[model samples]
Target: MKATLILVGTELLSGGMIDTNSLYMAEELNKYGIEIGSKITVKDKIEDIINAITYGKENSDLIIMSGGLGPTIDDITKEAIAKYLNKKLVVDQDELNELKEKFRERNLKFIEINTKEVEKPEGSVTFKNGAGMAPAVYIDGIVCFPGVPIELYDMFPKFLKWYSEEKKLKSDEILIKDLITYGIAESLLDNKISDIFTEEGIDYEFLVKDFGIIIRLQSKISNKNIVEKIVEKIYNRVGDNIFGEDSDRLEKLIIKSLKEKGKTLSVAESCTGGLLSDSFVNVSGASEVFMEGIVTYSNDAKIKRLGVKKETLEKFGAVSEETAREMVLGLKTDVGISVTGIAGPLGGTKEKPVGLVYMGIRNGNEVEVEKKVFKGSRRKVRERAVLHSLFCLNKMLKRK
Candidate 1:
């Protein structure tokens, strides 16, 4: 099956707001073996929306639209869809009552303007919005969702369930898996698995994320063994670089590995601030393995808190391997990780440059420090440093 997505919002066109709903919808549809042929983004203008709808109706089997479904005057998606489909706008009494009840439960006044949320095209199937007041509308093959992400997320499942039961869409049994890897460049990875990617009935997508690179493998064949064999072939070629699959996060994996081994970790940060610590702490049950995290940004703080000598700071500066090693050594844990870097638009010397980072990991009596120069803005540099530190820590833990 083929689908087209129309995202309607002036804010999205003006770069004031990002359109992430289309991505979610595309992924969801692809899971059902539906291919997205086109994605259109239009302003809140009714004319533009109508044009997009006309185009979608002519070219696509299923049209999904998101945005401009609100109480505000600029919310014209329902009107545009009604005009395109030659259907009259009618107020859904049940939806209107639900909206009114929601407002009354929250002790908020329900003005007449709020009634717009319950208005739908004639003969359209309306889905309840669990997250907000705006109801989702489906007419013919077209589906409309609220601009709000939370509302769309909540309503989409119900819509999908209804469509599945009503249409009885056959599943193609398409399967997609994301194999996440770090500490390797995309070029090298592609070169290593270049031959395997060309195999029939399979597709590959290489996405560079903030944490690492993700290799998405999709299998058209329904057989589980065939998919596993294809995955095992890719694994045999580049298994060492693969960390986890699908939604597995590097920090969560590290925490899980540490907990499994009954090990604890401590961290000291300089240029990355508390980002590394924040990543680790975001995982549930991290307190079982995470002992402490210290952000020693200043030389005095490094000396006082992490036991870095004043002489070491004077000779090697804060963004040095020596300083990173000392910072890690200061913390007492089964594993100690430290990051020191120059993530800067300024504060770079002739010898030391911006994006220069030093990460140190102390495991038992063994200590390892790696120096790298990343390229990006200050925020990007710090993020890369933190991710690299986690990658190093993961490797060290795996070795132990």
Candidate 2:
């Protein structure tokens, strides 16, 4: 079943707060065979909440609304839901008793605002909040949750389990192995694998990174034993370009390579800034193999910090194969990765249009440099550069 997520908060709309809740919810829901159809952030207005909730109910089978379940005047999620369901704001005696017990456990008295939290919409099911005082409400198709992420995270699973069972969805997926290939365009890859996906009644997802692509095959099936047979058939067709299977990020594979080789890594980033470092560090055990990361954005920093040659910068500009090679050569560490690129909505000349990237990797005495023109926005260019850098490093690591 498809679900809609609505995040309500004036803080989120005004950029006073970051909405991390929706991102986490979307990924988790996808794993449970529930697709996230729509996600939006609305203000704390009661009318806005009611309108959003009503609209979600009509289009989506399940609506997961976050924020605005507090006792403050701005906390209008509960009231808006009550108004939409045409139900009264009746005080829940069981919830009131629980509130009193909680306050007593804390050696405190129950206040009026806290009493307001006990007022859930009539005929609504309350998912008890183990973490906080505010309870989440589930009335028919709609599940309105507390704005606090900690409380919402704890309550979310309980509701999902209940809803998934009611909807009779099996949490099983067909697995297929992908053959990874480099130096192949997406259009070409699709032309090759499109027939296989259709013949097997399977779903395919591709993640393009650095200089390689990861193709994933998934199918929803009743029998678990059929996964091996289907995977073998796909491998027979496109086994040359496949890397690893089942959503393995390139950074993760790079980390595994470093661990296997017993080697350390350092990075010198120019146009990509610290984005590449951030990606590597996001891995759980990065500290084990990743030694250092430098964001030498300016030529002066590149010369002073990474010891890039002045003559190379002058001869080959900041974004050049010479400069990228020098950035690696200047590295004090044994193994290094370098990315020099122009990620631009601006600052690109006719000769050097936007999205020109040079990624280089040093795996011993041998160093390899890849020069490519990526096409995308500034964020996409940076992301693509990082992916390519990791891919190059992964290949070099394998040769070692």
Candidate 3:
């Protein structure tokens, strides 16, 4: 089955709010083998909402609309859906009584405008809202949800249960696996696994995340063995670039690797502040391998805290390979990583433009420092530097 998602909110259209509801709905629908045909975001205008509904009705088997269900006059989702379906908007007396009882329970008086929450399109199946006042509406393959995330979350399961039973959908499960890869570009990874993507009965989706590229393989085929073989083929083709899969994060993997090798890690960070160390500490059980982390933002701090020499900072500057190496060597640990960079919209010299980063990783006596010039905003530069440091640490641990 195919579905269309419509997000209705002036705030979403005006960039004041993010539409996370669509992401949740898409994931849930995909789990039931329902393919998303289109996703539309429209402002709170009545005409636009009706047009979106009409478009979705023509193109999809199921249309799910979220947002604009409230007591306010601007919340016109129910009215617009009623107009589109050519149905009367009538007050559901039972739902109205429920709303009044809920307000009474909270020691608040229910106003006349609160009746909007109980109004539904004529002949629609109304699901009681356990989380909020507005009832969820479903009619003629269209499901309407309130804009509130908590209410939607509480009501979605009931809708899903109804949908499964009404449609008599087959029990064949949709299996999805995310193969997380780093240190590789999307185009290169796609080219390497082009053959596996073309194999029958499987679908592939490549998503670029902050850490790296996530190659998602989804199959509805009943046989699980075939899917495993396909995943194994991709793994063999990609090799070490594929670090972990599904919810396996890079920091978690790094911490796990360090623990397995019985090694300790310390960091001396400059331009990235304590971001590299923060990533390491984000993983649970990080205290088992993480030793210490210090952020020496200024030359004085570098000298006082990490023991970076004045001569190295003067000659090679703070954003240089020599400074990074000195910082790493200053930290006393089995594994030492240092990052010094010029992440800035300002304060960049002609010789050292913005995003000039030097990362140093030392395991035992062998130390490797890499000089890279990335191009992006200050936050992007810092984020990229942190990932690069973690990737370098992963390589060092693998070598041991």
Candidate 4:
């Protein structure tokens, strides 16, 4: 089914904020096999909002409108929908009492703002306000929701069932799995896997980037069983190199890998400066596999913590392959991963250029070190170093 998205905010139109809500909704709708035909943004004006709804009704099977649903004078989404549908705005007694009750329970003063929230367009279905004061409104195939991220997240997912019941949206089946890979461009992965898709006739897509790759697959069919079978068939073929599945990041994958393999990890960071450690520890169960992390940004700290040789720092500087190797191997953890680099606008000589990075991984008695030169701004350089460290560590983890 075709859909339209209308975002209302002067701030968004003037580039004061990015319109990420539309981006998120578009992708979510696509997963339901519902194509978005048009998207537009307007100021918090009644006529503009009404015109957008009018246009959407004429063109699309469904329309989703966000913003202008807050409890303020500028909150006009409900009013605009009422005008477009030629309906009266009447207070729903149930919702009005709810607002007052919540205020009373919290010992806060209630105002006309509470009454304003219950003013629904005539003959509109008011979806419950689990996440916010602004209740969702559904009228004539149009679903309007609040702009708040938390509220939208809670409310929009329920739209799947709502649409299926109300609009008779077909439950088209698609099973998707993602594998995150690095050290490759989107074009290159497409080159490697494009031929497979052609020969097998199994639909697949690649989300490629300098950060990493996420290979996704979904059957262009309506049967859940058949769609899932193709996903399994494809996964078996792309096995070990598939570090992550279903958009899980390197940290989550590593944690799972370590947990399954009964191994543990540690980090020694210089240029990456504990980013690697943070990535792992962010996951809920990472403590099961993450032993510790050491941020040795200085040469003296590296020597003291990871036992890098004082002479190595004097001869090759802090950002060198030799130093990285020493740092990784010298770590007391079972698996020691390290990164050292010149993430810089300054601090580079002719011999040691900016964006020069060295990464090291130590497993048992073996130490592997690799060096590369990245070109970017200071922050960009740091980001690249952190990404590369994760990528390399991911590969090594798989090999073990």
Residue-level lDDT of model 4, residues 269-304, one tens digit each, is: 998877778878888998887999899998889988
Quick one: best TM-score, which candidate?
1
lDDT of 2 by residue, 13-91 (tens): 8979998798678656766778778887889998888788877887888899999887789888888888888889988
- As a TM-score, model 3 comes out at 0.81
What would the per-residue lDDT of candidate 1 be over residues 186-298, giving only the tens digit for each residue?
A: 99999888787656777888989887899988876465566687689878988888888988988999999989999889999999989989999999999999998999999
Error of 2 at 375 (Å): 3.1
Location of the lowest summed lDDT over 10 successive residues in candidate 2:
171-180
TM-score of every candidate relative to the true structure: 0.93, 0.74, 0.81, 0.86
Q: What lDDT score goes with residue 113 in model 1?
A: 95
Clashes of each: 0, 10, 0, 1
lDDT values of the candidates? Answer: 0.88, 0.81, 0.89, 0.79
Regions more than 4 Å wrong, model 4 = 100-110, 114-118, 168-172, 177-179, 193-205, 209-211, 222-242
**Regions more than 4 Å wrong, model 2:** 1-27, 34-63, 70-75, 84-87, 90-119, 122-134, 146-154, 162-170, 173-186, 200-218, 221-243
**Pairs of residues clashing in candidate 2:** 67-147, 179-241, 179-242, 180-241, 180-242, 180-243, 181-241, 210-387, 210-388, 211-388
Candidate 1 Cα deviation (angstroms), residue 41: 0.8
